[model samples]
Target: MKFTDGFWLSRPGLTPRYAVEVDDIRVDERAGTMTVYASTTRIEHRGDTLNRALLTVTYSAPAEGVIRVRVQHHSGAVPVVPAFALAADPGFGPGIHVDDEQGILDAGGLSVRVHRTGGWQVDFERDGAPVTHSLARSVAHISGGEGTWMHEQLALGPGERIYGLGERFGALIKNGQTVDSWNADGGTSSEQSYKSIPFYLSSRGYGVLVDSPDHVSFEVGSEVNTRVQFSVPGETLDYHVIAGPTPKDVLRRYTGLTGRPARVPAWSFGLWLTTSFTASYDEGSVTEFIDGMAARDLPLSVFHFDCFWMREYQWTDFEWDPRTFPDPEGQLARLHDRGLRVSAWINPYIAQRSRLFDEARERGYLLRRTDGGVWQWDLWQAGMGIVDFTNPEAAEWYVAHLERLMAQGVDTFKTDFGERIPHEGVVWHDGSDPARMHNYYPFLYNEAVFRALERRYGVGEAVVFARSATVGSQQFPVHWGGDSDSTYLSMAESLRGGLSLALSGFGYWSHDIGGFEGTPDAGLFKRWLAFGLLSSHSRLHGSSSLRVPWAFDEEAVDITRQFTRLKMRLMPYLLGAAEQAHAEGIPMMRPMVLEFPDDRSGFDADAQYMLGDALLVAPVLSADGAVEYYLPEGEWTSLLDGSVQEGRRWVVESHDYDSIPARVRPGTVLPWGAVDDRPEYDWADGVTLRCFQLPDGYDAETTVPGADGTATAFRVRREGARIIASSSDARAAWSLQAGSATATADGAGTLTITIEDNR
Candidate 1:
């Protein structure tokens, strides 16, 4: 995708054409838009402008603070126009002004100044301060022998860092990196990503989303030292410039344009145990693992069956392999009787070895080759044919298979491997261009299965462990960082990827607890166990070895048990945050910058994150169990030892296997369910509300979500030495306990107490 050899000339077999001069600048005040026409060929006279080639740039506002710029040459339209469309409020119309003398047209905060007979530049600003600018010869419509590309260069300021290219694992800062917005199954070690979104936010408080489902290549300060350049293969390129005063605001505006993530169930927040991929397992193996965890007092909620549950070369048949799982229905009944939910692995690909493949082939439900035959590839499975999600019947067929599994006691699906879609010499059922279908395939595939589950179970109960996603795939509840090696370095990278994805509008994310590629050492496993249990979704999975706690060491089991129970006891607090995620477009797991935008220490603090604006989690990333985390301006209290740590300073600490670094911010009313062993229960029953470091005159409120997603709010305030608690819903009962201080409410539905001491 790199065009230039060095800086002076294009590489071999490449031709570069750039827009040089603006021949004409026309502003239509009535329509509130402007158009600048620039030609690669110089305009000699008025007669020469008739058929001469020109790059037409049009600027318009789709929303109050959103500006869309489209550059085009030919009139031919793209084959597959994506389903993404901007939704905006019409009441706040854009403010447009045109200065003919200065050749500047300003639309809201975006301004474009074109030198009438000289070079053209477009600058986007907020409060008259430049965020990014496109200089002369930066916008180009290039044509090689058989390919056409449109390129643009945006200015990058010093000390500015770019982030959020969709589930990237490389670095927290994307400077000096070349990224491609193409989905690939390259695992977590390489630059390729499973969910590649063409959106990036800069620390300079601005973001750009290239509005294309097709492949987009970005050279972030790499191709040019101080410029972020992106190009796509087409005659036209459309992008949006979103303005924000902070990084979090940029994400709010971005998710407002793209879809926000759906809120997952509260039970999904607990620790999940999976039958590791390719591990030898049967009902006996599963029962032993479950019983072992129970014996160790480790709280486990959801148990997942990996791909081996199905017969070899017959993945996604949606049937439990009779050879190993002879009585899957009864086994699942037994697990449920023991109070556990079940999740099974599934994908959209139908292998030819599967019994349903012939039926699909005969019914024309699979993707077809140019000669009207089914397209088959022998990558993950033998003669696998991808289910054509573009076909309604194919989607129905896929859902029918999942429905059968659901009927057999499957609660959710580990939907995997939609990234390896074929784009060459293939035809879609809806006649969509194959090139665009490569990235969009995951959206339709996950949506089909998710909708089926939602139809069976009501809303707020359906969830999927999805891997690949596109622009709008945030509609799915949970996705995990894919295929990581078992190491400390890989664990840090996985956190980076999750933080990046959360910034991209995903509310919940997960990863393999002990890493997905290899058998982790005991130290790594214990550390990863703590990190995974604290995430929005937790699962223990691996490639070669079993991920049971005892498989690593005895200390691993202890660490896993401690964190699992801690997460289960914290469900009341976490689910309230989940409700907020559904209401607003915020994430349950937030980067430090999202919550503390004014704190300069938070801009690069990827090592720690705020779990829903209250509890801060800093995972032990090294074998020594040493951690250095920052606490913003607050009187933070440790969740483990109940010790207080002052804010606005760095704290260095060492932890054992039984504890990790977790703290609650000041004035936080964290609701805890009475039951510490199970995640899903009457969250409102016997809720023990804990108040942490309530400052004088500070007020806090907590909401407990019912099974139906309705919440009951409880408000509490501190005045001088007295504390008052009240609830709008009188039927709800609550208790307060912080450290040694405990207060119980009478039947009057309000509690009043005077603190004897600041214990």
Candidate 2:
């Protein structure tokens, strides 16, 4: 991907055709496009244009505040499918003007100008100020023995940092990192990502999304030292530069272009206790775990069946293993009777021993090679053939099995193992290029299952605990951090991945509570319990052992109970956050940078995050519970205890399993739910408005999500030393709390509580 050895020398044996100068520029007003023909070599004399290639650079506006730039070497190359799905505004028309000096195109406060007499220069500006631009020799058509590549380099400003390449576990800042858009089943603590998004968000209030599903290599300040270079092996390179005055603005525009995360059900937010991969898959074992949680007063919501639910060496057949699960329908009914949802593990690969494999092979529902043979692999199963979701019949065939499971009362599915898609020696049913289908495969795989769930249930009620994701996979509800080992280090790494995914436009994210591949100690499990319960979604799962909290110690089970109940108590606030995610495309769990863009330390802080816009959650990464976090200048109050910590600096403290470094932002009217046993409840009824340091003359109105997916209005204001809270809905009761002072209203009334100053 790095063509130049340094700044001055090209990599040996690689042929580079740099776009030196623009020969002509053309504009089509109807299409809102500007095409610039740049000569590969500088035009000196009449003979200088004889035997030279020209690079065509096209500029257009997809939506407001978004500009698409496509650099092409050959215009006649065949088009490729399986690209990222973008929903461009149909009636958008950018203001185009070309003078003697430059050509300008403006769309919604963002503009791009192409210098007429410069050495192939294009400058992007916001509000008539410079953001980033392409300099001389930055656009090139690269060729070597590997293949042809279309390359583009954009300059990085001083002190500008990069973030978001999807589920990365390294440093939060992405400077000096070489990343590729290849999805792999790499565990936590590696450069390889399970969900690899071909996008990078700049701290300078902008983002760039490479519009390619094929392998894209990015050299971020690693090769050029001053610019981010990306290359794709093809004739054309298409990308979009989304303008943002803020990082949140950038994500809003980007997710609008791609799809936004769907609204999930309320029960999906509660604690999900799974039969870990090593647990017995019989009904007795399932009942024992479910009964154990209830006996210990641990609030359980969902019970998941892992891979052992199916017969060995057979997957994608969607049949319950008869030896263990003799009555799938009856078992699901029993779990539902206990007020618990059910999720099952599934993937798109069909093993040879699967009952549907031969039918799929005969019906062309599996990917075929160029030699007209089924492409088989033996990594996770015995001779598994990936289902060809590209074929309409194949997708229908695949969803038929899901419909059968839904009839058996499965509420959701864990779509796993999509990162192992083959990129070579394969042909898709729809004639999509194989390389492009590699990352795009997960999109199709998750979409088919998600749509099936939507059809069975309604929209906003379907859920999938998917592991692999692509650029547009955020439309699905939930995605989890994949394959983490059992350790404090892996716990921190999992947090890093979740934070990265939040920046990459995902709304809801979850991870294994006790880690995925190993058994954790009692302390680690208790620590992860606090972190997991605070997440947007919570689940207890492991690889080779049962993940029941009692498996660790009594303290572990107690910790599980306290945190799970705490999350349930916090449901009103969390459900409101989920509504923001569904409406604005913002994530429920946000990175610190998204909350505090002006704070320099926030860009580098990955150890903590803001749960919604109110509370900051710093998971205990050390066994001793020592955690250090940053807070801007404000009055910070702990959500766990009524203790307060002053902000504007670093604070380190040790907490027990009953507590965490969770603090509420100042002047926040946080909604505390009434029920602590189940997540689904009438939120407005019996709610408590916990006012945290309500500043003088503060007024804000917010909504609490209702059970039927509607929002109820709540208003709060601080006048003098009295803080008043009121709601219009007369069907429920509410309360107010300010600095140890508490008052309750019966139904549909106002609660006024006067705070004592320094009493």
Q: Which ten residues in a row have the lowest lDDT in candidate 1?
A: 93-102
Q: What TM-score does structure 2 among the candidates reach?
A: 0.99
Candidate 1 Cα outliers beyond 4 Å, as residue runs = 5-9, 26-32, 41-52, 82-93, 102-118, 746-748, 752-759
- Where in model 2 is the C-alpha error above 4 Å? none
For candidate 2, write residues 1-759 as lDDT tens digits. Answer: 789877788899888999998888899998999888899988889799998889999899999999999999999977889889899999888888887778888877688899889688899999999888888878999988878999999999999999998899988888999999899998997889999999989899999999998999999988887899999998899999998899899999999999999999989999998888865658888999999999999999999999989998998689888888999999899999999999999999999999999999999999998899999989998999999999999999999999999999999999988998888889999999988899999999999999999999999899999999899999987999999999999999999999888889999999999899889999999999999999999999999898998889999988998999999999999988998888888899998889889988667888999999999999999988899999877879998887888898889999988889999998898999999999999988888888998888998996887886567787999898898888888777888888788898888878888887511
The RMSD of every model to the true structure, in order and in angstroms, is 2.6, 1.1
Q: Lowest summed-lDDT stretch of 10 residues in model 2? A: 750-759
| 231: Cα error in model 2, Å | 1.0
Q: What TM-score, over all chains together, does every model reach?
A: 0.94, 0.99
